[model samples]
Target: MIRVLAFDVFGTVVDWRSSIIGELEQFGKSQGLQRDWGAFADSWRGGYVPAMNQVRRGELPWTRLDDLHRRILDELLREAGIQADEDDVDHLNRAWHRLAPWPDAVAGLHRLKERFTITTLSNGNVSLLTEMAKRAGLPWDCVLSAEIFGHYKPDPEAYLGCADIMDVAPDELMLVAAHPSDLRAARDAGLRTAYVDRPLEWGQPGRYRVPFEADEFDSIATDLLDLADKL
Candidate 1:
């Protein structure tokens, strides 16, 4: 039986692209600047993996997602020739903490939590995830993050560390994620895997694709609510 349901936060539970774009739109309107914030959000997210890889490869020190987001925000602003003061930049960088959950996230999680221990197993920093949970009203029993493991997702440590933290065997834990690579990693670590189809995770129709193979995940559902139903 699955004793714990560990979720991937950003795209899996919350709609980061839409949330980030909403914040960017508000900030742009406040500053009388107009740009394709969707593209801007995409560009900012494009830096995420490479930044984490830098730390993973030992080229850079272990940095929290908050710092990485800020660093990427600064670089993006420079590259786009967007002018803003330090205060503006800092405030804008914090938009990650204010992301909104997907329509089914809270309700589905509540349903799943009735039967299993539900927590976060995300690459986000603890403080960032905590703030986001509060802002988004996410009802996570515990918020676990890469900060605790010193490794990002797809890293064996991050996956196994979550099971360790919950004091459960890897098989007793089920990782529910939108990304197949994340699910594959958890599966490789001996955890059950459930794929939640997040069709618009990248803010475009064609950006996300569910794996065709039925064996790719232990369970696959159209959304978290559907996953809850399947469970």
Candidate 2:
């Protein structure tokens, strides 16, 4: 039986693209800066994988997502020729904390939490996840992150560590994510996997697509609510 259901927060539970774009738009207006906020959002997010990889590969010392975001933000501002005070940059860096949940996220998580221990298993730092949960009303029993393990997703330690912390075997933990890479890693670690289809996770209909290959994941659902119903 699945005792705990772990979630990947960024694009799975919350709409990061829209949330970041919204924050950029507001910030741009205040700074009298005009630019393609969507592209800016993408540029900032584009740094995420590489930033995590640095820590994953031992190329960089253990750094929290907050620091990574600030680092990436500084680079982006310099590249874009945008000028802002340190306070402004700091506020902008926190946009991740203010992300809004997907339409079905909160209610579906509530439903699943009734029958299982629902918590985050994201690469985001614990503080970042906690703030996001509070802002989005996410009903996580507890927030777990790669920061805790000093490793990111796809690392065996991160996946198995979650089960260890929850006092459940790998098979008793189910990882729910829109990203197949994350689910695949969990499955490889002997955990059950559920793929939630968030086709617009990248902000374009055909930009990203979720495969429903029957053999790949234990289950595939259109969204969290659908996944809840299946469980």
Candidate 3:
């Protein structure tokens, strides 16, 4: 039985695309800036993986998620020709803090909490994750991050690291994620796996025909509520 259910926060538990797009849109409007907010959101997001990949490969010094986001945000604004004052830029850099959970996320996480210890194991920095949990009512018993491990998901260390922290055998921990790569890393590290579908995670809107990664996972669910019911 799984004693702890660790989650990938950005797409699995929270809707980052919609939340960021919405925030960018509001910021643009308030600043009288004409911008393609969605494009800006996408462009800013484009830097995330490569930034983490550099650290994963030891090409760059370890960096926290918040700093990575800020680095990308600066370039993204310049590329978009959008300008903001220092206070606004600081606020914009912190947009990750306000990410919204999917409509079913909170209720489903609540249901799962009745059965297991729910916590975050995300690439999101610790402070960022904590702020998001508070803002979105994510119901995480505690937040864990790449900041804590100095590593990102898809790395065996990051996946198995959770089990070590929770003081449980790998099999006793279940990694719940929408991303197959993240889940696959967990499985390779000896944890059980659950793939919870988040069709709108990328905000392509019906672009995904299916989100299955591999047949190795122990179970698959449409959402956390379904995963909780399965357990």
Candidate 4:
């Protein structure tokens, strides 16, 4: 029986695109800036995994997600032609720390917490997750991250590490995620899995291939609320 349900935050627990673009829109309007923030948002996001990958591979010094985001934020600010001062840009860059949880995320998590020990297992740094929990009222029993293990997802250590640190057998820990590759890694590491469909994660609704299925996981659901019901 599963006692814990660890979440993969970005697209799974919160909607990064809408959160980022919405903040960018507000900031842009406040500053009277003229630029396409969506492309900037996309480009900024494009830098994230690679940044962590470099640190994980030892190609670069160890850096947290906030630092990696700040690095990319500076790079993209010039690209987006946002002429804010350093302090303004720095404040804006930390917006990820304040992203809004998905419409169903907070309530769904609250419901799940009644039955399961819920935690976050994401590439996001601990400080990022903590600040987000404060901002969005996430009810996590504990927060786990790549920062804790000094490794990112798809690494067996990061997957198995979660199970080990939590003192649970792989079968007792279920990874609830929207990303296929992350779930695949967790499965290969012997953990149970649930694929929560988050087709709107990329933002802008559209038809696309279902990249994973029930065969890839122990269970699948349309959303966290549905996942909670199935479990």
Compare the candidates by lDDT and give the number of the best one: 2
Q: Least lDDT summed over 10 consecutive residues: which range in candidate 1?
A: 203-212
TM-score of each: 0.97, 0.98, 0.95, 0.94
lDDT of 2 by residue, 1-231 (tens): 889999999999999999999999999999998999999999899998999899889999999999999999999999999989999999999999999999999999999999999999998999999998987899899999999987899899999999999999999999999988888889999999998888887898848564546789998899999998998
- Report the number of the highest-TM-score candidate: 2
| lDDT per residue (tens digit) for residues 1-231 in model 3 | 889999988888888899999888888888998777877887888899998899999998999988899999998888778788989988988999999998889999999998899889999989999889888888998788877777788888887778888899999999999888888889999999999888888777545435564576899999988887888
**What are the lDDT scores of the predictions, listed in order?**
0.91, 0.92, 0.87, 0.86
lDDT of 1 by residue, 105-159 (tens): 9999999999999999999999889999998889999999999999988899998
Error of 1 at 139 (Å): 0.6
- Cα deviation in Å at residue 212, candidate 2? 6.0
- The positional error of residue 183 in candidate 1, measured at the CA in angstroms, is 0.6
lDDT-better candidate, 1 vs 2: 2
TM-score of 1: 0.97
Clashing pairs in 1: none
TM-score of 2: 0.98
